[model samples]
Structures are given as structure tokens and as C-alpha cells.
Target: MTDNGPAGGMIGKVAVVTGGGGALGGATATLLAARGASVVVADWNLESAETRAKAIVAAGGTAVAVGGDVADDDAVERIFSTATEAFGGVDIFHNNAAAVHLARSDGPVADLTDEVWDGTMDIGLRGAFLCCRTVIPLMIARGGGAIVNTSSIQALIGDTWVPAYSAAKAGLLSLTRSIATQYGRQGIRCNAVCPGLIPGVRTEPDMLERILRRQPVGRSGRPEDIAEAVAFLASDAAGFITGQALVVDGGLTGHMPTYGDPVTSPLDAPAAR
Candidate 1:
């Protein structure tokens, strides 16, 4: 990193990361803490959040864990309260929490039930609504703040299983824009990162090899890949950018599928490390 590094202006800032218990969220929370931000790791799973918080603290970074459902307005308030009591006002917020049951009910919209649809929206859409509603004022009060929301590649595509997941993420993109436009004058900026297939590549490379070979980048995306994007969007570097949905899918969405897999593709010769 240069004198003005990747996390410029993040030092001493307070950040709240919803879903910090998960792979991408935990990685983002850790990265922010390492860059001199005090982070509150909020998650529905109390123990998961606590574990991540402990690891951050152990690594000489500042972090605390708050456990509750992000979809609950009361729980959302508690999250903000914890952030305030721990590190003053919120300066950076990463809305990354979500829920879905893909193995059981996620399918074509016609095949999906109320439970699957409602559950997905409750966390993905409603949860984002509550967090943004609560964080916007805090951000304004603090003079300025950055909000990085986790949208998905699913939102922009047609082929997919989780219909509710796609709809909720599409809603997230719209919500991101609304916040950015409405609060740009109030010193608040909001943006979303639409990450492609993620989370399993690290632990299930063998099983994911086929899908990994399809990415134009010649590899599967890592959680840190998304985390780094979140860090950039939440940093001073992106001060002038907002209301944008950045596609961080290693060019996976950049093709028309005619980049046909030749014999030289990663599938034929194991994906390059």
C-alpha cells in the first residue's frame, strides 16, 4: 500500500457490518478493523458474531459483536445503539445479512411458497430497509458516512433458482439508489456490490471446479474478493461515487456465452491459482 492506502480516511471510523458472522461479512469486518476502524459485528447468530469479534480483537483490532435479527426494527435499533456506545456514531455500514432456503423451496416463482418468499424478503429486503432507515440519520448527524450494501449478480440475470433472493436483491439495488439520491445532500453515500457465485470455492474447490472454469477471470471468487470491493466503496477513495451497483464477478456477467469453452479452457487444464 502507498502512503495513502486502500483504507484511506477509515482510521478511527466506526463501522457496522450486518451478517458479520458469515464468510464475506466476517472478512469485511476484519479488513475494516485492520484498517483502523472500530467494527460492530452484528448477526442473527450470537455465537458466530462473538467468535468473529473475538478474532478481530485478538488480532489487535477493535471490534464488538451484537446479535439479533436485522429484520426486526427493535433489533436493528439495538445494533446501532451498540455501535454508538462502543465507538460513537456510525461512519460506515455494510448491509450484508440475508436468508433463504435454496435446498428446500427455492425455485421458479410458481414453485416457491409463501414461507420461502417471505423469509427471503424479510431478511434481504425488509432487513435492509430497517438498517438503512436507522443508519441514515446517524450518518447525517456524524457529518457524513458511507454505506455499502451487498446486492447480487442474481438481480441482473434471468437464469436462477432462488426467485425470492433475486427479487429481494433487485429491491436492494433500488433501495441503495433511493438512499444515495435522497441523502447525497446530507453527506451520506450509498452503493451496492453485486457479487457472483461465492462462499463455497474456498472449501469445496473440487466440487466447484466446473463452475469456476466458467468465470472469465480464470478462477473462483474468494470472499476477500467481495470484501475488498466493500472496503473500497466504504472508503474515502469512493467519495464521489454513489448510487452505483458494481458487478464484482470476475467478468462472468460480461459475456454473451459465446466465449465458448475451448480445449484450452480452465476446465481442460485445472483452474490457475
Candidate 2:
């Protein structure tokens, strides 16, 4: 067991992170553990989850690995049950699991299959719903807690491919607001972290290059970038923040859509007298 220190904002909190084995999720899980929160690293891949949990333990933090799919109701129960049994109850929940495989199968709405669409929504959106439903009562019982859903920049923009993924992420933002408004009176806060292209994690090389050019930062986002945002929102440091979608895309969505077009490039225009 890890001791709750005075300096950590998450001291004594218990957090459940779905997809905690992935790059972004693992980073968030590690950071949360470092901040004095006992973490439950739940993931569909048991070995991956164990690897993350062991790393935290080696670092003198408290954590456990649970193998399960967030979309399954039974698995969702097992996830929180592990948190409750191991650390008493949940004080934070990070809904970060996603159906990344959808990228291979996703296409324009006209060519999209039911299987692909269902797969995306089931894991991306429904999974979040299941987690929120399961953890809210536990959080309320503990007097309050934080929820940070992992949305995507696609949620706020139009894309030719991956229509289902985009829709699910957009749906998540709506759910975030609903949860915050309905449960804020009970001290339960919910929000989302919309990430831009993080190289090697989600975006393809060609797509990454195109998006990176449009991003004002001129670089792909790091897993730590999103992780830090999640940690802050999940901690008391962001106690006043709720029902909001914090976009961590390095200003990818803050500018005009035609920013990278050569014809519209201000840098290429003739200098004014």
C-alpha cells in the first residue's frame, strides 16, 4: 500500500482507469499513482495491465491489474469491485478505452458496415456509459469523485474516414455534459479530454503528417500531454472544473480549417507597404 503524502492532490484517492495498459492510459495511470492515488489498471489485455501495475508497485505506489472489457457489464462490475475490494472505493474514473481497430474497417458512412459501426460505438461510447453508470454510485457513496473521458479531436471536426469513431467521440462530449449537470449536486464531476494526433498510438503516418502541418505546435502530442490534463481534472486542483471538454490538441482545433492551404497561407502573401 502507498502512503498518502501531504503534497499530492490525489492523496488517499482510489482511481479506476480502463484501458490503463495503452500508452496514453498507462501514462495517466502512472501519474495518478505517483500523486498518491491507489490505481486499478484495468484492460482487455491482462499481461499489459499486469505490466503497468507491477511498474507502479516497483515505484512504491499502490495498484492492481484487472483483465476485462469495459463494454461488458460483468467486466465493468469486476473492475470497480477490484477497486472497492483493494482500496475501499473509487474516487476517480478515467474512461480511456477505445476501439482502435475501427480505423482499419471504418469508412465513409455510405460504405460503413453495421459491424464496424457497432464495434466502434460499443467500445468507444457504450463502454464509457457502462463505466459511468457503475462508478457514479460508488463515487457518490464516497461523497464525490471525478471522471475524465478520452474524446478525440475528430469529435469536434469533420473527417472523411472513421465516421463511426468520430460520432462516438462526439457522443461522449454530450454524455460528459449530461453527467455533470445531473450529478453535480451530488458532488460528482465529469469531463472529457480531447486529444489530437499522438504519433504511433492512433494516427497513421500519412494522416499524422497532414494533421501536424495544420497544428500550430508543429509536433505530434505526447502521451504525457494528455495524461497531465487528465490528472489535473481528476484531482481537487480542478475542483471548480466540470462538464467541460478540455481539448489537448496543441491548438489543432483553435484555428481556421484552411490554415495549411498554400493558397490561403498568410506567410506566402506579398508584404504590405
Q: What's each prediction's clash count?
A: 0, 0
- Per-candidate TM-score against the hidden true structure: 0.91, 0.95
Q: Which stretches of candidate 2 lie over 4 Å from their true place?
A: 1-8
Positional deviation of 7 in candidate 2, in angstroms? 10
Tens-digit lDDT track of model 2 for 1-273:
343233246878899999999999999898899888899999999999999999999998889999999889999999999999999999999999999867889988989999999999999999999999999999999999999999999999897888999999999999999999999999999999999888875566888888878889977799989989999888777889999999999898998877887787877788888
Q: What is the overall TM-score of model 2 with all chains considered together?
A: 0.95
Tens-digit per-residue lDDT, 24-94, candidate 1: 89989988888888999999999999999999999888899999998899999999999999888999999
Error of 2 at 147 (Å): 0.6
Error of 1 at 111 (Å): 1.0
Clashing pairs in 1: none
